[model samples]
Target: MKIPFSLPVIDADVIAEMHDTLTNTGWLTSGPKVQALEKELELFIGGGNALCVNSWTSGAMLVLRWFGVGPGDEVIIPSYTYSATALCVMNLGATPVMVDVKEDLTIDANKMRMAVTSKTKAVIPVDLGGYPCDYDAIKEVVNAPEIKELFISDNEKQEMLGRILILSDSAHSLGATYKGVPCGLVSDVTVFSFHSVKNITTGEGGGIVVNLPEPFDNAKELAFLRVLSLNGQNKSAFEKNQIGGWKYDIIDQGLKINMPDLCATVGLAQIRKYKNELLPDRKKIYNYYVDALSSYNWAIIPPFKEGSTESSYHLFLLRISDISEEQRDEMIRVISEKEVGVNVHYIPMPMLTLFKNKGYKMADYPVTYDLYKNEISLPVYNGLTEEKLHFVVDTVVAAYKTISGN
Candidate 1:
């Protein structure tokens, strides 16, 4: 039986919604469905204003750009995350300072605090594999007087945070929580991905959640981001469709990255079933793997539930204890040969050619390197059955033993 790493969960309801959206909605790009999705997400998350976008990359870019993180400014990020976390900073002419993450794969708060300088404009803590970073601890560090004094404020956004902006790279953690609060509400700003591999999908989409506390108006921030998402147009296509609303103004030189109604259709459908079916099913599969693999002393299962926060159970980041990098690769190969697919979450940014050429050294981040060497992301999706879950665990255990010559 061939069990692939991950698959999108789409049922008849999703298909029917997309069909209805296409057939009924005349204003396709950023129309009623998109507006409805924004509202629905806001309600689902319990607070914060939601802005849907074409991708998490673009949503992050918008946040950095809005915060005036540009030329000579430094944005700190975990070295273990996808390159987009660093690349977004680079695209804005800002420098990305790669930092090490903790054993749990979240960004280290102490390292993050120490990394802050007068030039540091923001710090993006990635929720890798749908597990939230320790936002409470990170917040205390951000709020520290010493760190607060180093902030260089040039805009309203910078003024509000009073220090480095904590923009959460929550691409893997939409339904997650941190300290009992929803993922979106924990950070000053949070970005979530709705890509096909994610727990919820719009084929390809993302969302920005504004948690910037009042005195800072979230609605105004949402409007500003909407302008930035649509090539700086004062009015969107849907707005312009209104009678005598054709005339509009170009406010800022923004890029085009708004989520269309077609994507929103899927998002709307998915959000409805997310809590009741999607999350619960994924949790079951995650537990199944945990139960099946618990006896293996070599297996280091990821923590989905810790304290009050719970992961969305998106990716199962399993690590092989005492296994060398070479042996881990061989294990993956053997598992694939047996028709059980396996994959890695990431290769550290400093190890990548792009960031390496830019003068980053992997040697600086020992923990990130160690985590990457043995980490494997197992398949955990909505449609995965108990049988496939058991098969995957059995295959992985056998492959590891075989590769280790045990």
Candidate 2:
């Protein structure tokens, strides 16, 4: 029996929703379904204005672009996160100042504070492994008088906020919460991915919840971003289809990153069952992994919740204590040979070829590499049979035992 790493939560409801969207919904691209998805997401995360986009990268890039992140501008990000976080900054011709992460794999708040500079436009903190970062601490860093003073606003959007933008890369943390509040409400703007492997899947889509503080109207900003996502055209295809609505003008040089109704359909369908059914089910699996593995001498189970912060149960990142990078690789080989698929959450950005050649030294981020070397992400998706779950646990145990000879 081959146990895969992760799977999209595609049940009957998802299929039915997609069918209705493709066949019944007259507007396919960025229409009613997308609007409904945005509304549902907004309400689900409590009350931030959520906007659906083509992808997480697009949504985040739109935020960076709105803030006028360009050549000479620096955006702080954790070296432990996915490449998209840094790629969004680099794609916009801005520099990504990488920092180490905490034990929980979330960006280190102190490291982030030190990375802020006069040219710093934004800080993208990644909620790695479906867990929310220490948002309260991160907020303090960005809200500090020194950090605010160091920020130089070059665009109207930045000037309006008058501080460093905290654009959360919450790709793994939609249902996650910190301080009893959802991820969206903690950051200035939180971007969630609906990639197949994420907690929520929309084939390929993203949602952005705007929570920019006072003196800045979030609704107005959301409206402007909608136009920006539609390629500078003031009128969308759905709007233009209406009577005499074809007459529109190019507002600015914008991007084509609007979410289609079809993709939004899946996200909406899944979200309807998220809080009560889906999230709890994943959390059950995460808890089971922790409970079953906690007693082992070599196993180092990652925390799902600390203080008031809780994970969305995205990935069960179980670390093998006292293991070298090479031993971890060997353990993975043994697990794979047993047909139980496992994966590393990430190979820290600095260790990657793209960043390594660009002067990003892995040694600089010690915490990130320390976690990366021994970590192994297990599958935590919907519809894992009881048998499969036990099989996975047994396989991992045997693999580790085989490698450790204990």
Candidate 3:
């Protein structure tokens, strides 16, 4: 039996809705479906304005651009995160200061604080493997007096200038919670991915949730920025159909990154069915893996903190104890041979050629390297049947035993 690593859950309802949306609506790009999806997402994630985009990378770029994080600015990010996290900063001609990860594989808040300087503008903390980072701790460090003094020269301006924005990469944690507050509301700006492989599928889509500090008309600002980000157009395709609304302006040079209605149609259906219908299945598979793999002395299960009831359960990352990177790779190969699909979460950013060429050193991010060497992402999707789940778990155990020569 072949057990796939990840499979998206799509139902007849989703297909029917998508077909109706495509057939009934002539305007596919940024139409009623997109608007409806955004509104529904806002309600689902509690209160905060959401701007749907073509991809999470584009959303991150737009957020960074909106915050005036450009040339000569630096954004601190975890070394263990996806390349897009740092790529967004580099794309803006800003420096990406890679920091170490904690034992749990989230960004090290202390190291993040240490990485801050006069040029430091924001910190992008990733919810690695759907585990929530200590946002309160990160906020405290970002708001420290000493750190503030270094960034803000004037005592009066310290409050405003010294503050570092928390741009959460919540691509893996759409339904996750931190101390009763949803992930969308926990950060200054949170970006979520709706890729085919994500907990929620929209084929390939993402959105940005803005939780602004002041009452700056976030809805209006987000709407305008989204329009500008897509094509620098003053009016969207929807607005063009309005009587005498075709006349619009191009404010700034921007990229084409708007989410289409087709994608939004799928997203809307997923949001409605996610919590009650899909999440439980994912949790069941995760619990089964945890229970089956617990007895292995070499396996370290993913962390689940107390009171985190709404975890997205995006990936089940397991760490191998006392194993070299080569042995870990070999273990994954062995698992594949057994027809159990397993993959590594990521390689540290510094190890990549692009980052290494930019003078990023792997030696500076020891903790992230340690985690990367031992980590393997197991299958945990909504459609895993009982037979497939058992096969995956048993195959994992067998691979570990074979690699350890037990």
lDDT of each: 0.90, 0.89, 0.85
TM-score of each: 0.98, 0.98, 0.95
Model 1, which residues run further than 4 Å from truth?
Answer: none
Q: What are the per-residue Cα lDDT tens digits for candidate 2 across 34-130?
A: 9888988988998989889989999999988887889999999999988999999999999999999998888899999888889888899898888
Model 2: worst 10 consecutive residues (lDDT sum): 21-30
> What is the C-alpha lDDT profile of model 3 across 292-331, one tens digit per residue?
8898888898875557534678889999999999999999
Output the lDDT of residue 146, model 3: 83
Measure candidate 2: CA RMSD. Answer: 1.1
- Residue 386: error of model 3 in Å? 1.4
Q: Per-residue error at 35 for model 1, in Å?
A: 1.3
Model 2 accuracy (lDDT, Cα)? 0.89
Better of 2 and 3 by TM-score: 2
lDDT of 3 at 266: 88
